[model samples]
Target: MQEAVIGLSHLFMTVFLCCFANFMVIPAITDVTMAALCPGKDKCSLAIYITGVQQAIIGLGSLVMPLVGKLSDTYGRKFMLTLPITFSIFPLVILAYSRTKWYFYAYYVLKTLIAMVTEGSVQFLALAYVADNVEESRRGSVFGIMSGFASSSFVFGNVSTRFLSTSATFQVAAAKSVIALLYMMVFLPESVVKYRTESTETDCLLEKPPTKTWKLFKTLPSVNDIICLLRTSPTFSKAAVVAFFSNMADVGLHASLMYYLKAQFHFNKDQFADLMIIVGIAGSISQITLTPILTPLIGDEKMLSTGLFFSCAHMIILSVAWAPWVPYAAAMISIVATFAQPCLRSIASKQTGPSEQGKAQGCITGICSFANIVSHLAFSPLTALFLSDNAPFRI
Candidate 1:
């Protein structure tokens, strides 16, 4: 256990710092986007529209993740772990330096292309890491504990952004990514022992290794494997669909959240940070405690469904929130809803054999990617349209 924790320390620490950087980006991007796109307008709905475009790229970027995950299974987790963080530095630096819409557009396009290899995939990687290292019997509890630490990074990250300039924050994030890479290079060992052994066993069975690159390419999962992974397992498929809807709801909220609060309540960066801090604290606590306690009593499926119902409640409450504090109330009420992702991961990871954990997570990430495309196209524009003069939900 101690050795496993030591090996996973690098992975967990990197995830925390990356999440910190991500939370920092949330508040700054809205203002940067507004300044870049439409400086004169007080309520710049166009910023939301551009966010939609960026999310579309992120969604499309998810296509490569399954392949990356497969590559991790074949090669080792270190490369998949390192590559995304390495490539993401360019996009962060570009955002910090550039102000023009054209530059922003370039960043988004490049961000999409390199999405599989960045800090955004940290949670996905962490999930796989836990699946890889932990005993199957103890995975659920360990996953929750790990997720709690990861979620808590948002609190500190949000607070940090309140004091720093936007450029400084971005630079800090970029620097953190660099540090994460160094830590991984120096300390993180491979978490693919089972995958390596299983592959070796299979290779030993083969009389001779094939020469063609086309045949070599056959080592990774195909389109059929991606689809079949989702379709074949009832629990995994349900979790996938739930994750899809969960992300759809989440992206829709996120697409409009900052804008809505800023437009209605006149929330500045500090206020936005406060909201994130509240949610982050509540979520981190709940993430650590709730799933382990409930899973034994209700099992994974019941726990999942319960979390979804609470999540749906969260969305509905946020949609009709009449005052600024209402979002905070909704946050508190939905602490248990944070259980959804960990439970979903726990269930799916349990169903999958050890050797295929990467494929399972890749499939899950693929479903979320498709949802991002749909949510980006749907939610951001809808928020813009609603915030306009001729809409039904005028406040």
Candidate 2:
């Protein structure tokens, strides 16, 4: 038990570092895009279109995330975890060196390519790692705790960004990413020992066995495999439905919110950081404290519903903000709204056995990735239209 806790602590530290590196740049990226693509303009159609295109391509690449997860079940979480963290560093280095128009385009291209593999893989792998070590009964709280660490990192990253210059933010982020990768490589232990043993035995059983590399690819989860997994459990299917729409709303809000704020209120990087800090602090408190207490009492289902309801409320408030402070007020809703993901993930994790945790989480993440593609397609145009001078109707 002590060993498990120690392993989880290492995992949490890795998550915090990686997330801090990633989130620190969110506020600065918008300004960079605006300056590069449309200098002095808050609303840039080119920036929106480019972002949409990049998101679409990344979503398409993320379809392979499940494959990586499935492979982690055969390999090890520590090994799989290294790939994304390492890939994440390259784009940040590019941006750290320069944020000029040509350099921004270079960063954009590399970032899109890297994000396909790096985006959701870290979180999903971490969740699967937790599932490997945690008991079913305690999975919800543990998942919440893990998310809380990420939220804390989000808050810290944004706070750092609030003070750092734009160039310094990217440079610091790249450094942190390197640190995260190294820490994981050195400290995090493998969690799938039993699965690795089973895989070895299975490999030995084959007559004139193929290479492990070929077998790994051959065993990649297919469409029918995902379908079977979904149809095999009613609970999982319901969770899949929730995951799809929840992620759809999330991606839409993420894609539009910063641009909307910049256009609607002329928010700069510091204002963006302030807004994110509110959401992060609220989310961190809810996940770290409220979730563990409330989930067991009210149940994950009720918690999920409560979260989704408030998530909608917050988005509605943001859409119709009368004052700059309204967005900050709406961000407070994340205190409860943040309950959605950990609960949803907990419920999903319960549907699969220990050995299949990676596959199951990957499938769920793939569903969310598909939602990202759809949300980008639908929301990007609307955001561009509404934010542009010639809008069909004003909000």
Model 1: lDDT of residue 299? 74
The TM-scores, one per candidate, come to 0.89, 0.94
For candidate 2, write residues 220-252 as lDDT tens digits: 777776777787778989999999999999899
Candidate 1 lDDT over residue span 238-346, tens digit each:
7888878898888888788888887788777677777888888887888767756666667767777777888889888988889989988888755788777777888
| Candidate 2 overall lDDT versus native | 0.88
Top-scoring candidate (TM-score): 2
Model 2 residue runs over 4 Å out of place are 1-6, 193-214
* Displacement of the residue 162 alpha carbon in candidate 2, Å: 0.2
